[model samples]
Target: MIINPELDKLYNVRAAIPNHTDIFADWEQRSVEFSQNVKGQLDLRYGKGPREKLDLYLASEKNAPLHVFIHGGYWQAMDKSQSNFLGKTFLDAGINVAMIGYDLCPDVTLRELVEEIRRAFVWLWNHAEEYGYDQGKVQISGHSAGGHLVCMLLATNWLSYGLPTDVNPIHSAIAISGLFDLTQLVPTSINAKLGLELEEAKLLSPLFVDPQNICPLLLVVGSDESSGFHQQSDNLSVGWGENFEQLDRMNAVNCHHLSVVALLAEKQSSLFQWAIRHLGS
Candidate 1:
């Protein structure tokens, strides 16, 4: 049976054009207002290039665990400000939240974007102590494209950065409706902007990567999300086996990709509670 009616709306390789425009506009407006509410020091740095600046929202407490959240938009859309709503959950839980912004695709390659995220994580690691965060207690979470990035971070070699080989910068990862494999999207028009080749797709897919580290991972997906999204989560879970733990799926009570963030904003939600428990431990 058909699972995602929204996916049915797309006539060709292109996404449902109208929905894309509407969602992006909503994100832009939300991000603008969210930026205004940020208090304390906000560090903006061009870590990789002219456009590659990381925007960090520091919480009032210094000794709290840090939650690094990455935005979605299929790796081509969305901005850091659009995801500011996430700050409320972790902040209320007595944890500091870091929202990351990366250059969108078609302008910069996905490989470059992934590397940029890696660099941002390193920046966070180097500055963790100064920021009053426990580098050992860091948690990484992302939605959609961000979710893909979270998985990529999990697969990285911590030893290469002079960090402990046993130390995974990301102690726990909360990946919501993440796309783990780029190969599935090759047939879609997103590939036009993503510029994915077969070889590149295989190399970048987190599902294909080995999961040797045993980090607790929480994979969440809206019940109403597309079949492709569900498949992505399933593939990652299968690939990681026991290294992935505390797997929780949320139907989100009538939520879509955009609406899921509202659930995340609710500190009492399963996703938020699970993340807090993991980060606290």
Candidate 2:
């Protein structure tokens, strides 16, 4: 870890949350129950890789917009199973939800994980008609490392991806408790797993990337989260101005890194409601 005491506290999410394990355990149990109870396609392969599968939960038989959610594990730890509960909010609102998973770092470079996410979107677009979703309306949301990946997706030019010019694959995006500038991460203990250099971090950071067609960019972080998370969201909103028609940030009240994500499961949560509104528009 870096010699900076404050930086260590800021970046070490598990250390910050003493009971993070229990939180995740509950998440796993709840996610399993949700998956068993909900009816939709499970373990759908988005890419050829073993880890590049996604779970899609459709609310109704009729067509609706799709909400693509990415799970965060600092690009290493978690998978989409813990994220299945997130789809309930969108499903209750009569929307389809797809939770994406990617190969972790060290095993596969972060760059390749980004490509896998792009390919996941490619799969979604190609299968939209079959899935009974509106291809043009996709609202992207991610937490932590997933947030970073969401920004990368936002910056992507769909035309280069062979997407139709008339159709917009991404309508709006939300980054929840995300780390935007990864340079700070390289010096932290997490770098052991991320294996990131300052140069590579800068190259992939949404802060530096030029966004393609700006959508409504919403940045969010738990108020009780470490200062690093708040600064990441604030800084990205300031830096990615050109990529968003309107920019906003939500300081989730009395929540931490893990708890803030719980807000996504709450129908009345400002964050969840905000996502629903933007997705409908």
Candidate 3:
């Protein structure tokens, strides 16, 4: 493992959070219960890969705006199953929710994972009519690595992916506790699993990519998260300047990395309120 002391402390979230395992377990159990209790299509495949599946839950029988969520595990660890609970608040507010899944690293490169996410969106757009959602009113949000992916999605060239040049697949996006620049992580122990070379890391970083459109963006980081996460968000906002129609940044009070994302499950959370307002707009 690469042993850079400063970077390790800044990015090694699991090591810093003593109860991270407990948090994961709670998220898992709650998600499983929520999935069983909620009515939706489960394990719907978006791509041919075994892990390339998503779960969709609509607010009602009517056609509604869609909220797509991507789970974060540094691109190697979590699953959409742990993210199912996030759909409840949005669903309660009459928005349809889709939790996306992608093949993890070591099994597939990070670039491949990004392509899979893009493909998932394309699939969603193609099936929007059948699924009863508004194709034009889609918003996306992600936590941690998923947040990184959110920025990548913003940077995507939809036309190159076969979407018409006039169409914007994403209306707005939220990145929670996201890593924008990945070069710092290369020398850290976290890179041991990711296997990101220096050039690939730079190329994959959202900080370096030119955003494809001027969509609204919300950047959120936990108040108690490490300095590295705060730095990443700050850097990204500046780096992607003027590219987004609206760029708002927030700090989830008294919360750590994992706990901040849990705020989405709380109906009264500022995070959820902001989401509801933007999604309805």
Candidate 4:
């Protein structure tokens, strides 16, 4: 399995490594187990639509820190249910995990998806008491398209959302193997589903946005990722400017875009443990 980093692998991760059944199988197996074995709420609606729902896994610690994970399916194909396995480790670390779902592309524009993400967090913050999670501190992490949405959330104006002005709803974030520049996808096969013209692509690209008021953010990409993927992660850190100095880093290491996020399933993996520290903060 010699993965050439410079190869012409497009944004579609599954295409690079066609045999991803094991990865998805492990996710499904773990997710189902965690969902059944753990005590949590499922299909909790944050918006009027049916797809705008979230799942929350509770931790032993009362008022535990919160972590929200968004699933990646290029904004069209996946659901929060597929990633419940992520909640297992966060729960063990005494952080509540909220897996959010959204209406997909074509049916709903990327702009609408962004608003859905914003509304999802706002719902979490407002209903923290019922969920038994701390509202004071929150961290976020997303893989692939989820990572893209994570950055938009980081750049969002919480105040405009009627969230507390004293503290940002998000305290820390990590975007794993995420696509930051939407324009890059315009010419790719994914664009057929995304339908992004140059203007729409630029308008939605988090890489081009300056997230000045955000908390600490870490951009990670797989060492075996395509050159385009690597470029996006690096550019995001640089675009953050001085904030990059605080947590300014882009981590590239063993795995491809798909496999990189699979590290989340390993409780002791560097990516998971590193995220645990962020939740503690």
RMSD to the hidden true structure, all candidates? 4.0, 1.4, 1.1, 3.7
Better of 2 and 4 by TM-score: 2
Model 1 TM-score relative to the real fold: 0.87
By lDDT, is 2 or 3 better? 3
Which structure is stronger by TM-score: 1 or 3?
Answer: 3
Q: Give the TM-score of candidate 3.
A: 0.97
Per-candidate local distance difference test: 0.74, 0.87, 0.90, 0.81
Write model 3 residue lDDT over 28-132, tens digit each, in one string: 899888988898898899999989999899877477899999999999998998889988888878899999999998799888999999999889888999999
Candidate 2 segments exceeding 4 Å error: 1-4
RMSD score of candidate 2 (Å): 1.4
**Candidate 3 Cα lDDT to native:** 0.90
Order by lDDT, highest first: 3, 2, 4, 1
Residue runs of model 4 more than 4 Å from their true location after superposition = 1-8, 250-252
**Model 3 CA lDDT for position 170:** 89
lDDT of 1 by residue, 3-109 (tens): 23344332121242337557657766766666676563454673856556665666667767888899887788767777776686677677888888888888889
lDDT (Cα, tens digit) per residue for candidate 2, span 1-281: 45456677798899989999999999998888887889879889988887999988886746688899999999988999888888887888988999998899889998899999999988998999998988777888999999999989987888878888775678888889988898878877778877877899899898888887577878999999988999999898888765566988899999999999889999999999899888773
Off by over 4 Å in 3: none
